[model samples]
Target: MSNLNKLDFTALEVSGRNYLKWVQDVKLHLTAKNLRPAIEEATDKPVGEAEKATAMIFIRRHIHDALQTEYLAEEDPRALWVALADRFDHQKDIFLPEARHDWQHLRFQDFKSVNEYNSEVCRIRSLLKFCNETLTEEDLLEKTYSTFSASNIVLQQQYRAQKFTKFSDLISVLLLAEKQNQLLMKNHQARPTGATDYDDGTRAMTGGSRNAFVELPACVIMVGIWVKDMTDGRKLDVMSLVSEDQHED
Candidate 1:
């Protein structure tokens, strides 16, 4: 008996937009059970009773109602799979233009972390590939570099000086830089104020001379702007601001 428990097709149904990926998942599960040939092969050759039964059960249990009504009546799992693919696969055609628009306009915002920004780039790339559009590594690298926030000047300069054949390597280096910058910022935040005892046994208070302007994190600044905009320029309480930042994070 095949371990059908290992595959849960319910999670694979993510609407028409993800139909291709869902079909791929179904095929992989079928292959694992030694039943893929029943649906994938063009031969009219009969499969074992067990294989045929298993395929039918899997398909009926997993497919969405919209797909099942149209395809399941065929009673042949292979035909049903093909019919579903033919119907829902046109989603890429419908979505390609919107995806392209998003890619062209996408940029790293001050409020987003390096990881978050990188993930969005990867997502756009995947969507484009699903629509039968391919972007080379060079294209990806250029897109990633061009989308960085204006605050990331040091990183932009460092990356520009080096050549990376792969986007992953560039992401790794950027993530490391981001981590180091975060540590430095934390240290700066924790540094002591300027009050010290001199050798003449006099205490000197240099608080007045110390810089009072503390640079806020980009995310915090963005949150403040958002709150102000949403409330029509009304200021929020400190706790409310803190809560909003927590939610955003």
Candidate 2:
């Protein structure tokens, strides 16, 4: 790392189970510190003794305590790099086949949610990449479309019609659609049967110099009642009133 005083990632494990990832992290940190050349097999320019010591110290700082003692006498970072590689490079063979299997079986429709499906996709893709296998964007999109539930064939076709160039863009649309569906379901459950709409009338003023009498036509007034649930055995209540108005001459 640029600042060697701080550790950017976990130190290499003594068992070497994390060797591949640790190797990658080491290379990145060494590169950031401009000490990569000291550990490289072939370098266009010469590496100074002081630079080698610096690279050695950086590598030692990122290794397990047991490893530090195991390679305590090692002076050159390049030699230590080769020694570590020889000891743990077989991990590639150990993990590649499983990564391939996981990649082959990953599917979008198999997951309950888009997030879960996406997580699996990413995990498989990362493992494949670490094994030196490339999982292209087209492959990702096709995998999702082909694995769609049988009932969603039409929906899958609609998404394919969008001709998405990036997997992220397509997944974003899928996630948004999922959230909207959930909201609609929640609203439906909140009110199983819909409610009625009400329209209100406006008030007006009409008069002769001295207020006279007026007889309005018989009118119908509508009052709506809210019905919570029909299956709950609650009684519905409604009322209607009729009255006559008298005016003086």
Candidate 3:
């Protein structure tokens, strides 16, 4: 009843959880209308109706994908945009309400039996947890892939390839390399005061400072020239003196 913004985040973690619960409640209410049809399609003994269960699976995937995209970017717009666009086949509007509606209307009609329905429900329940919803961690683990995201997998690769003198340096490197580069750009302002101390110290010790990863992407050729200057004695020789003077006369 009181203003939620007035509450301290450290002491009052309930608001965030409540808000997500509210959203999920609304989504479930809207989607429940379609569940019977979906179950019917998935459970039907006839092959014609049974094939329709695939549609239900697709719908569930869409719902999960939408929630993950929405929640991931809710705090970081840039990352949200990047994740929604890249992860969902370049679809720019993953958060649209229409998507939620379409998912709600999806139907499945054929499954072998109650066991199959239970099995599918188990899978769906795990996926729902991975999205921003009400589910236990144990429930999530039941899924074949508990945590699935293309960006994360790629970042893992980048993290593996990086070589840093310090652990933080490697983190910075991996942050920039990930396709969801936006994730790194968010919550940056909330970083602890000492988080950058190592980087700053390194820069000062070297007498030069540059965020090589962020900068190189902006002007790669210029970076090459800068590197050349640094490596070649910090000098650029246009022509030396002029062997041309002797030849011109």
**By TM-score: ranked, best first:** 2, 1, 3
Worst ten in a row by lDDT for model 1: 197-206
lDDT of all predictions: 0.68, 0.78, 0.36
| Candidate that would win on lDDT | 2
Model 1 lDDT per residue over 1-249, tens place: 133455575433436666766777778888898888778766777688688878888876676555556554687777776767777788888878987998888876532577987788788888888898987899878877776678877777778779999988888987898899999898667644332223122111212322211243222222123335465878665445544554665
The best candidate by TM-score is 2
Question: Which prediction has more favorable TM-score, 1 or 2?
Answer: 2
Misplaced by over 4 Å in model 1 are: 1-15, 44-46, 69-72, 191-249
Backbone clash count for every predicted candidate, in the order shown: 0, 0, 14
158-236: candidate 2 lDDT, tens digit per residue? 9999999999999999999999999989977664342212112211111221111122222323335433446887655
What tens-digit string does per-residue lDDT give for candidate 3 at 164-239?
A: 3443344344335443545655646557533543465445433343443223332122311322256657655312
In candidate 2, how many Å is residue 187 off?
A: 3.9
Give the TM-scores of the predictions, in the order they appear: 0.67, 0.70, 0.16
**Model 2 — which ten-residue stretch has the worst lDDT?**
202-211
In candidate 3, how many clashes are counted? 14
